[model samples]
Target: MSRLFRDVEGGPLCPQGSVVCIGAFDGLHLGHRALVRHAVARAQALGVPAVAVSFEPLPREFFGKAAPPPRLTLPRAKVEGLLALGVDHVGLLRFNARLAAISAEQFVREVLIARLQACEVWVGPEFRFGKGRAGDIATLQALGVELGYTADEIAPVLLDSERVSSTRIRAALSAGDFANAARLLGRPYAIGGHVIHGQHLGRTLGFPTANLRFGGKVPALSGIYATRVHGVGARAWPSVSSFGTRPTVDGVEPLLEAHLFDFDGDLYGRRIEVEFVAKLRDEEKFPDLPTLVAQMHRDATEARRLLMNEQQRATA
Candidate 1:
């Protein structure tokens, strides 16, 4: 069973000598996966539990308000994916102002040493932490010696001659390039949320969609997509999704609205997972409701065809 631990302070929970990796792990993309794999391997070799320690309200989100870009994965989805990757435990640390003020030495000494007792630590080459981002691989290595442990930096994972990173993934998603993003993530780009009541405009247009109001940071993409909707998971239902500010409806907040083909029955408050399969088109303001409805029909057709082919390919 995978354990999910939340760290409210700049402290750890596991006992000492545990093998661990630490990072924001926002997307848990291929690069992050490589580091986690290394940590897990080290844990297996040392006969200790493998743990991944990450932060909530990520330091960047808390500190970089001016440049807050959309996140790739929410905490819940990231935790689910990490568990699927065979991680034994996950730590979701709360990154408040006080926790952010801890010095690197104190983070290592009090948290990593006293609480976690980590015998070995894995981090990425560009990873940095502690008060004002003062910590680096070199500092961690030096501290490892004094603290009686080992530290290693994992190199970046690459795809198409570019380093796989959360930034790159977000860019791909914004550009509506699901294939490229999936190549980097080793899975489909997904948005998970609960179904919510909307203005029922889609029903008037012959498409009764399940509107999803996400809980955490939204993704960068805003457009029509060919998607797969999963809930009970018997099979991924073909879907046409629109992610945007709904300008036509005068809606200001972004929403993920998915119209699952051949699906009926109330889904209000039900959790749904929408996986991006292909970008159908960029969102635009239509001159009239009739025009928008026509475009939606075309999008639904394209989404169905793409999903059918994708399912066949998977079966083959």
Candidate 2:
């Protein structure tokens, strides 16, 4: 699949006729996968390219003026996951006020109809778009009839009789129910960012953590978690990570400090991906540095044991 940045000009460039689906696709959860798969299937049947359109910064975050909710997948991760899904192209639209104001009618006519020449448009059952979220499935269908195209709404994919959504996944993660979140997401929950410097308290305590600065939206789950760190080598190393303001140090601004087992490389400025395997505890304030250090040691040992169990289970 091809991933487009904002640089590609000249409007939508799809093959002669294409099937397209558009959404924020924040997490690319099971629900999104179902919709995307449907669009791809339709494209295959029509012998056309399947194009997935997604907005960067999400429309809400751009206009809301407040920090948007923590996203499950950042742009890079989203693009990687989309490519793995085997779609023909992913349109990463840069959302600006000008593009935002385009009426739903005009969007369909200009982007979908004239630009992409889409033969079929697939959207989620509850999909809404255009100025002020004014368009719905019926509007799309009506427009499709006028434009010689077909509009189809794919029902949400359900898990345990409930629809899987990015919101639900976020809630589950915040509650530290990673198993359930992973089930909905179809993969382990991960956060991506560049390694930044920390207070070096962990180093003084003999932990030596690599602090990460969030690049996309915020992060889910503010607690201690068992994680797997990537970018150290071919395999992701098991780690124990804490996400919160270090109360013992009177720290501010939530930070993720991960102590990689047996790792001693300079990771500053390196972009790394950390996958959440399990949650160990909620963030808490320790009475003193000694107490915090003791708790960290316990966390490390437990994390190592859990990682071994996971590896053994996989082999079995």
Model 1 bad stretches (over 4 Å): 8-12, 309-316
* Highest TM-score scorer: 1
Query: By TM-score, how accurate is candidate 2?
Result: 0.88
**Residues 1-316 of candidate 2: C-alpha lDDT, one tens digit per residue:** 4646452246657748889998889889999998888888888998998888888878887787576677677787787777677678787878888778889998888778766789999998689999899998899999988888999888878899988898899899988888899899898888877889888878888999889756645776688988999887899989999987777789777788999999988999988888888888888988888888899999999989888898899999
Native-structure RMSD, model 2: 2.6
TM-score of model 1 vs. true structure: 0.91
Q: For model 1, how does the per-residue alpha-carbon lDDT over 178-255 read when each residue is reduced to its tens digit?
A: 888888888888888788999999999999998976554656788999998999358878899999888777877788
Candidate 1, position 266, lDDT: 86
Question: How many times do residue backbones clash in model 1?
Answer: 2
Could you report the Cα RMSD, in angstroms, for every candidate shown? 2.3, 2.6
User: Candidate 2, which segments miss by more than 4 Å at Cα?
Assistant: 1-9, 193-201, 245-253, 268-271, 312-316
